[model samples]
Target chain A: MDTAMLIEKSALVLLLFLISLGVAAYQTYFERKLAAWIQDRVGPDRAGPFGILQPIADGTKMFLKEDFIPAKADKWLFIIGPGISMFTALITSSVIPWGTNLNLFGRDISLQVADFNIGILFVFGVVSIGVYGIMIGGWASNNKYSLYGAIRASSQMISYELAMGISAITIVMLTGSLSLNDIVKSQHGMNWNIFYQPLAFFIFFITSLAELNRAPFDLPECESELIGGYHTEYSSMKLGLYLFSEYTSMFVSSAIMAVMFFGGYNVPGMDAFSGNILAILSIAAFALKIFLIIFVIMWIRWTIPRFRFDQLMHLGWKVLIPVAIVNMLITGLVVAWNQGWM
Target chain B: MSLQMISVILGSLTIASGLMVVLSKHPIRSVIYLVITFFFISAMYILMNAQFLAIVNMIVYAGAIMVLFLFVLMLLNLNKEMEPETTRMSLFTAVIAGGTLFLVMITALRDTFQYGKGYVQVPVQDAGLVEQLGKLLFSKYLVPFEISSILFIAAMVGAVLLAKREKQIID
Candidate 1:
């Protein structure tokens, strides 16, 4: 690659990494505020200007707190666990197309980092590896609650992944290419995948919730029984890393949902604009979609109760998988029919 | 030249981690080593521009299968004290089996080197891309692909059957 391209990519990567971290930090604040609003109580107003500075305060507190490890905890794995969690969480954002191309310095700069041919699969691969974080953390802690939580997490993720992949396959089939940019381009001018494949979108949305370990599917860290679940023995920034990774994954998943089911950055009559204005507006539009999705996710988290472990497993295996497969078959028939395969 | 250097580096790392999988005393550690080996192997695939295969390899082996292996090992809690003593007969059988496998690998390597370049290379351009792979799978290798999918389904059914508990008739 040329020096300019290399520099562009590195800059984009750095920018994306910072954006993910920033979004995650603020997601925690929004989550608390939303939860408080849902429960009819005043949320944090002590921090600067409507508690906008709360995330910073929380972050500083996490850093300054005692970084404790249990006596029986496996030292290296304990450290590696949260690192893996945070790493996997952050890296999945690389493939998502955040906006349209911008023309700068006689060059067209794409807003995506690496537009790999197998972009969606890359996300899937990272997500599958995400389980190791909780598993290793729980196992390393040598605590029963942690182990139980880890086991629950791995099983839940594995079970939901089958349905999730199947649901995503419908979109892949529709797009006829694995590239996220292609998927977004195909949905130009408000022809979102959600309109055509609502069932698939439903399955994908539910499965994403399961994959993110958010309520009402959060059986892994059910506090009433497991007491903070996998991170029960964790403290300080070690705990902070785990929580941060969760919100980061939430951000990434919301982005994926927006890109896939929503029209990504494509608004009706968006073709009217061109160049830098287009790129900036598209980025703003994409960001708006992502925030809306995040709001709905948090709304569900506060509104719905956690599922029973068996109920979660049942929904994943018996309900979601079958529905996804049938939806995929119907989509296949439609695609084939459209292509004169009948 | 740099691609070759990267391939060589990844190849050696894969072998080293593969060796550690067997050499590690702890089962969980062995699984971790196996995952490392898988990562190196997938990196090699990426180096070859086999992006589709690389990610699928990651999703399947390092992601799904190894997670289950780690899960089982963690639950088993098999420490040194819990490890069963290796019998003489078992050791003898293991040695013989390992020796036979080594001989087979040696023969395979010898034949590969004799008939072709010392290193393997994918002959077709963009053969590792999803589009090319999909076309090839549907056209040239359709029967084998179908048969393998069938075999997978059979294996999945067998697993479910094995795991299902028989219903009890309570007196």
Candidate 2:
């Protein structure tokens, strides 16, 4: 590859890494503030300038703290646990499309790290691998609570992931493409799939939340039952990696939802602009949509009470999976009819 | 030299781990080793230019199947003490079976193996397998698919019947 292309690829990777890290950091602060606002209380105003530096302070605290490994814990596996969690979280975002292609220095550049044709499937594969992180971490901790949490997490994720995959199948049928960029392009203008496949959208959105272990569906880490769940024994930056990965995955999921269903980067009259300003504006619009989606997730977390474990299982198997399957069938029928293949 | 050497190394790792999976006393540890075996097998698949199969192998076998194994192990509460020791005769039979299998595989490889004859590099078609697999599944494999659904329903019913609690009658 040419130097310029190599440079661009490296820059893209670096940019995505920084964006995920930054968003994950702020999401922690954002969740707290949202929770406080919903409960009618002041939140985090001491750190610097309206507590804008709170994440920094939190990072410092985690870093400066003493890292502890339990005496009975498998030290290598314990270390691998957080490493796997953080790695899977970051790698899953590689296939997500951030914006349309931009022309820079006489070369066209796509606003994605990779544009694999099986992008959606890749995401599913990576997300499935994510369970191993929790399972290993919990198992290696050598605590009963941790082990229970791990088992719960593995089962929960496996169950919810089926619904998520089926929901994605609906979109794949509608778009006739698995690439995230292609899906975004298909949803260009005012033709968002959300309008056509609202049921699928809802299933995908809810399942995405569950997959991220967000509130209401956060049974894996349900403090009331499992005592902080999977990461109960984790401390210092090991715990921070777990928490950061959760929020990062949340941020990436929000972005995926926006790109897949919300006409990503395509505002009304977006075609009217041309040149550098338009590119910048489009990227800004995409970022705004992602941020709004993240805010809505946090809002849901603060509003909804956690579900009973049995209720969560019932919703997954008896409700979401069947609904998703039906939606996929409908989508396939619609696509076939549209293509005159009936 | 390079491709052959890499394949040999990966193949050895895969076979060794596959053996470890069966030989390991601890069920949980066996599952872990089996996962590693799946990973090595996937790597071998990738080396053979079967990217789709490699990914599916990792996802279905290593990721999902082994997680199920680990989950079952955890649920059963089976640890080292719970596992039964193999009798000397059983161990001997297992070793003989393993040795015979290895010998057969080596002999088969010696007869069938060929290098660099018709190695055509096919263009990587994006979503090719997914599209073809979807067509084959919905059309040619429809009967099997429907049968599988019926099987799943039967299993669900069986599980419910087995797990249902019975209440004692008051005299």
Candidate 3:
């Protein structure tokens, strides 16, 4: 690899890291603001102009507060849990294409950190590893509540992931490629996959909510029964890490949903724009779509209540999985028919 | 140089974690070590240009199976196993069994590594891709592929049958 390529990749990685952190921080503020708005109450406004700086203040408090560890807790695992959560959440961005490649210094520069051929598979694998953080942290806390939350979180994620993968298979079958870039590129003009695979998109949306532990699928850390769920024993920045990872996952999942379903970086008259202008506009368009999806996720969180554990499991397996399988078969037939194979 | 260095690191870590899985007294610790071992194996698969296998290894084994292992271990509540009294006879038996297993593994691996052409290092181009693998599996290995699907169906039915309530089973 040339120095310029290495530097470019590193720069993209760094940029993504900063963007994820910033989004996560602001996500907390937005969630609270939205929550208050829904409830007809004023949210934090003292910090900086309608609580713009609230996240910074909240972050400072998390860092300054005393880091607490339970006497019976396993020290090493407890410490490692939140770190793993944040790490997996952030690294997922590496495979996600931010926008089309841009030309700079007479060279083609990719916007993504790493454009692996198995980008979607990489995402699935990384998402699966995220369960370890919650499970380990919960187990380490030596709290019954924590353990219960951890178990719930692990089971729920695994259950939903199957449906999620099956639903995504329809898209993969439609596109005939696993690379996110290829998936996005195939949807040029007004030919988005969501229009073609609406059922798959529905399943994906619900599964994404479950995967992120957002309500009504947020049984992992349901405050009513599990008392903060897996992060019950976490305090200070450790707790912050857990919360930060949640929003980071939210951001990542929103991006995935937008890219897969909502014609990522696409606009109606995008073809009319010149090449370089289109690239810049695409990035902006991608960001706008991501935030819009993020807003919808938070809207659901406030609008809906948490599902009972059994109800969550039943929805995931009995309902979604079967529906996803049927969708997959339908997609396969359609693709085959379109290709004149049948 | 960097690639080789990464390989060396992953290789040693894999062996170490594999050893830890057996040596650790805590089952959860062992499971963690086993997961680490699986991750290193996946990394090695990536090194060999088997990216599909690498990701699948992580997804299936490290991600899914290991989480189940962890869940079961947590439910059992076995933080530490009761240390079996180390009798001299048992120690001697263990040493003999361990030595024999080690020797067998080493001999088998040695032959496997150099048998067909002294460790062919050429990476198969796009051999690990989904399209390439799918074509080969659906055409060349169609029978086995279909058989595996049938096997999976049988296994699923068996699982459901076994998990039925005792009253249901008796009925």
Candidate 4:
């Protein structure tokens, strides 16, 4: 790669990193505020206007708190646990096609960091590895509750991942490509995958919720049952990293859902504009969709009660997996028919 | 600086981690090292421009399978005190097995070196791409692929059957 291209990609990477972190930080504030509003109470009103600065305050507290390690904890692994969590969470966004190309300084710059051929697979791989962060943290903590949480997290992620993969395969069949950019491009001009593959979208959405460990599936860190779950023994910035990674993964998964089912950065009448203005508008549209999805996720979190472990397993294995497989078979048949194969 | 240099570095690291996998005293640490070894092997696959292979390796081996391995090991909670005593008989058997495998590999690899074909080239530039791989699998390797898939199904069914039997016994 040329130096200029290298610089451009680095700049884009930095921009995405900042955007994800910023959105995740704000998500914490919004989650609490929404929860309070749902409960008919004012939340964090003491921290700036409408509690806008609450995340900052919480972050500072996390930084200032004692960085505690349990006496029996595996020291190096304990430290590496949260680091891995944050690393995996942030890197999953690398494959996301944020917007169309921007014409800047007489150069066409793609908004994505790396448009790998196996884009969706890359996301799955990162997410699969994401289990390690929780596993290591909980196991290294040497606590019974933490170990239970770790086990639950691993099995849950593994189970739901199968359904998620099958669901995504339906989209892959329809789009005939694994790259997220191509998937988004295929869905241009209101021809979103959700229109054709609603069942796949539903399955994917539910699986993403489970994958993100959001409520109804947040058994790993369920407060009442597991006492903060895998992160029970984590303190200070270590705990903050775990929490921050959750929000980051949430934002990334939301973006993935948007790109896969929704029309990504594609907006109605997008052809009306051209050049950098179009790129900016597309990005804005993508951001708006992502926020809408995130809001829905938060809404579900507040509205639904946590599922029991058996119920969660049943939903993933018995229900989602079979349904997703059937959906994929139907989608494949339809696509094959369209291709004149049957 | 070059791809070769990077590959060399990765190869060495992979070996080191692979060694650690067997050398680590703690079973959990060994599993973690095995994961690290899988990651290095995946990286090597990337160096070979086999992105699909690299990612599948990561997902299946490092991600899913290794996590299960780690889970079982963690559940067992095998510490220093619980480690099995290494008797001379078991040690001798392990050495014999390891040495026999080493000898077989050395003999197997010697033919390629003798033929001066130790360095093989990827026949197609995009051989490892998903499209090319899929086409090849469906066309050329279809029967073997189908057979392996059937084998996998059999394994999965057997596991489920075993679990169900155990549950019935408990009831």
B1-171 in candidate 2: lDDT tens per residue? 577778778888988998999898667678878988988987876676656667788889877988998888767867667677889999999999989998999887766555433333333643235676677779999999989999999998988876663532221
lDDT of 1 by residue, B52-94 (tens): 9999999999999999999999999989898889999999999
Per-residue lDDT of A117 in model 2: 70
Candidate 3 docks with a DockQ of: 0.91
List pairs with backbone clashes in candidate 4: none
Q: List, residue by residue over A270-324, the lDDT tens digit for candidate 4.
A: 9999999999999999999999999999999999999999999999999999999
Poorest 10 consecutive residues of model 1 chain A by lDDT?
A211-220
lDDT of 3 at B40: 92
Instruction: List the global CA lDDT of all models.
Output: 0.93, 0.85, 0.90, 0.93
Higher-lDDT candidate among 2 and 4? 4
Residues B91-143 of candidate 3: C-alpha lDDT, one tens digit per residue: 99999999999999999998887675533353678787788888999999999
User: Better model by lDDT, 3 or 4?
Assistant: 4
Error of 1 at A65 (Å): 1.2
Write model 4 residue lDDT over B119-146, tens digit each, in one string.
Answer: 4343467789999999999999999999
Model 2 residue runs over 4 Å out of place are: B1-27, B44-49, B77-79, B114-128, B132-171
Candidate 3 regions with alpha-carbon error over 4 angstroms:
B2-6, B81-100, B113-120, B165-171
Put down candidate 1 lDDT per residue, A42-140, tens digits, no spaces: 899899999999999999999999999899888989999999999999999999999999989999999999989899999999999999999999899
Q: What TM-score goes with each of the models?
A: 0.98, 0.90, 0.96, 0.98
| TM-scores, chain B, all models | 0.91, 0.60, 0.83, 0.90
Error of 2 at A163 (Å): 1.1
| CA lDDT, candidate 1, residue B17 | 93
Compared with the true structure, model 2 gives a TM-score of 0.90
